[model samples]
Target: MSRLVQRITASIRFTPACVFPLLIGGSAIAVFLAVFLLPVYAKNNSLDRAIQDRREALERQELFAPIHARLTMQLREASSLVVGDRQDIQDTPKSPEEAVYKLSLLAEQAHRLGLLGVTPHPDSLSTQDNLAAELRLAGPFPQLRDLLITLLAQPWLHRLERLEISGGADVEEFRVGVSVRMDEGS
Candidate 1:
């Protein structure tokens, strides 16, 4: 063991000629790694994180896509049903009694349009000077549609307050309510 140590130490000399070159080479290699390899690794890591974040955002958008589409379609339907503010009805009722007369006229029109189970219930006046009435009817879809169009086309300022549709496949029952605003005089 003593002789082996002697031989090894003798072969590996700490001479300046060998030591300087080894030290310079190690330092150069370290500088090369710092200047080139480390920056490349850091940039690759940042790019991978950016890609992961974008994928998560895309996944979230995909999850809510159906809900967004449904809400958009509902908004379109509601907008089509809305009455614009600038439109003026020529012969609005001046009193609740006149409003009831108008409602009776609407019931007669509904009957003529072949709507069954036509029942109109006039409600008392609300605090907002609005006279409300509910018309319950059962009919085919076409007659119901025509009645709705006719109601919209009437020469009075009214709103379709509540609409409830029920029944089976062939026939539909509708409980429709209208609110007519009476002028302040009566």
Candidate 2:
């Protein structure tokens, strides 16, 4: 046994030449695992998370589809009444007074479409031929809540830019700014 142990020690010799190669090989393997394998694993994990998020989003959209469809039909009916009328008024309202009158008329039409307390500000003009307006209304809190929910269900490209609700007001109303853009070529 002593003779065999002596032979093994002689083979290694604990020399710098053999020790340096072993250290270099071990370090290369460590670097390869850290830089290559770890990033691939991380990327696969991120992809899985992204796929899960998309699936959840699709499910929510499906749940909202029926409500969204009803709101869209209502919007289409209202929009058809207002679209052509706007073109005639757009080019003619040069003065602020004329603008206000046109805005009021537009608000009235909007009110008939389930929108309450529609008010169009004369100052809400844009350089583009976009109509800007503010609407205020007061009603039962439940009705207001339903209106907001329905608004969220609207499929139009419109956005509710701002909303203000307060308890002390004469009417429990929410104020919202509404705008619609006219295509230039039209």
Candidate 3:
């Protein structure tokens, strides 16, 4: 073994056959991999980043989904409030008393809807082409729904501007702003 080691160490004649293939062919293969594979790796990383960004955007939309739906529903309600019933009433109210009477009918409708207390803001009576009054109501969701149904059934032009209902399961309170006209034509 010692003689073999000495002979191996002494026979150090460098051969280019294996060395040239390793140096030239290995470097060529490395360059080919860098050229072809680097862009593919970079493109895959960018696609991963894009997918992550889209996932985050979808999560944000899911977070705001309820709020957006509620706002959309409120806007639809306000738009539908402009629609009047088929009551063949006069074009407009000439006096506040007539407006009060009309609103009193609305109050009666509320009384049947399960709310015990109904108060009208007398100061809310404003004179434009016709008299408009605001009524404040406090009740649960069912009664409020009933009240809204009755309100739509009335042949009066209304701008249901604001409606806020807040509470837990059983009992709720209502804070709504409405402007009533004699008819949609007015």
Candidate 4:
């Protein structure tokens, strides 16, 4: 084996033929890498960059997850409150007489709340389109405010059409009118 190695090393020489083939083979391998493997490496690098960008975007979205959850909970709470208010306003009077009776009851409630001369004028109310009436009451400013709030807080679709207030600062007279309508869709 030692003799063979010596012979092999001695036979190999730095001639033009040997150097020429080695250079050609080396150039061919370099050309193959440049033509095929370089583009593949470039594409893999670009894909890695894209993956990194996506991971960063997902992390940014995770940062806002708590705010998104809080907003969704608040939205659900607001929706529930609106649903409760709609349920409260769902009470409707079946007929004009019932509507008048309800108005009288409201007037009595105002009288009980320290208002004097609580009167309801429902003579001009028509049942064909919508029920409307005017109420006259005399009381202090606080009682009038309370009566207005009570009227607005009733369990039906009620609209205040006109409001006229007159008198001194302490004892005020209110001529407030409201229009009541039933929802057809309900």
Candidate 5:
């Protein structure tokens, strides 16, 4: 094997023929890399960019996960507590006449619940398509609480926007503001 190695090394020389073949082989390798390996590298880089984009999207979703969860829970709780006739909201008021009738009916209901001096802001309905009403009530604290509970349970999707309760032991003076969407469009 040593003799063969020596003979092989001695037979090879940097002649024109030997140098010519080496140059051709090196050129062929260069051509192969330019034709195939370069495009493969570009495609690999594109895939890495796509993976980075997906990772950024996943990070954003994770960041908002708690807010999404809280909103879902609140919606579920509100849906579960509805205890009024849904039909009351089927007719969206198209004119002042209809709006007045609805307000009167609502006031009557409030009167029955020991609430008085009910007034609705018509401008609120025209401007924002929301039925905003204010009421004054002098009653026991338990009655005031019951009214608030009933308002929340109404199927019209009404919410108490603001409330002020001032009283001691016997009589409570309550000032309340409530609002509901006029219809699906509003």
Candidate 6:
């Protein structure tokens, strides 16, 4: 053999075992990092991002605190109006027949406010203390706008779930459905 080959063979034969073991150990560490440690690191990063998103949502809710407080106060005041002034609402119809009478009175009141024609329909009586009514009104555009403003300004809680307005030959007419829920305890 050449001098270089003889030296290489002698080094491999003597210090040999440690070189092979080191190579294998380095490869095992690389495989473990690729297959196990890398994925765990990626998962931790994703979890951190999710936590950040939740913190931002909580901060947004805190920013709306004043608006939420004001709305809650308005709702409480409206509810009290219905229950507190019992005398004013004492004549409100209790029976189905009487309810229809009261509805007519409300419709007439609407008509006087420049609404051309007003009609109110009450559904069948339920065991619950809730009352639901549908009101249909027809008139000029300006008058219809005014009527809606007045209805919304009422002290009682009235939810206008749906409103349909159509243009007619001489005027615009509106069909509105209003629902009122009264607690039995009230």
Instruction: Report clashes for each candidate as comma-separated counts.
Output: 0, 0, 0, 0, 0, 0
- Candidate 6 residues lying further than 4 Å off, grouped into runs, are 1-93, 111-124, 153-157, 182-186
lDDT of 5 by residue, 1-186 (tens): 999999999997799978999999999999999999999999999999999999999999999999977975575466446534443233555443454466445444543345567677767756545677777777777656645655555445356678898877777788888775555453
lDDT of 2 by residue, 110-165 (tens): 33223455555565554444556666755555555544444333232145567787
TM-score for every candidate vs. truth? 0.42, 0.42, 0.39, 0.42, 0.44, 0.41
Which stretches of model 5 miss by more than 4 angstroms? 1-113, 184-186
Q: Higher-TM-score candidate among 1 and 5?
A: 5
User: Model 5, residue 59: displacement in angstroms?
Assistant: 20
Candidate 6 residue 150 Cα shift, in angstroms, is 3.8
Pairs clashing in candidate 1? none
**What are the lDDT figures for the candidates, one per model?**
0.68, 0.57, 0.61, 0.66, 0.66, 0.59
By TM-score, rank the candidates, best first.
5, 1, 4, 2, 6, 3
Worst 10 residues of 4 by lDDT: 111-120
Quote the positional error of residue 92 for candidate 2 in Å.
13
**Which is superior by TM-score, 1 or 3?**
1
List per-candidate RMSD values in Å.
17.5, 9.2, 15.9, 19.4, 13.8, 11.2
Displacement of the residue 105 alpha carbon in candidate 3, Å? 35
lDDT, model 6: 0.59
Error of 5 at 125 (Å): 3.8
Candidate 6 deviates by what RMSD? 11.2
Top-lDDT structure, candidate number: 1
Which candidate comes out best when scored by TM-score? 5
Off by over 4 Å in 3: 1-14, 86-186
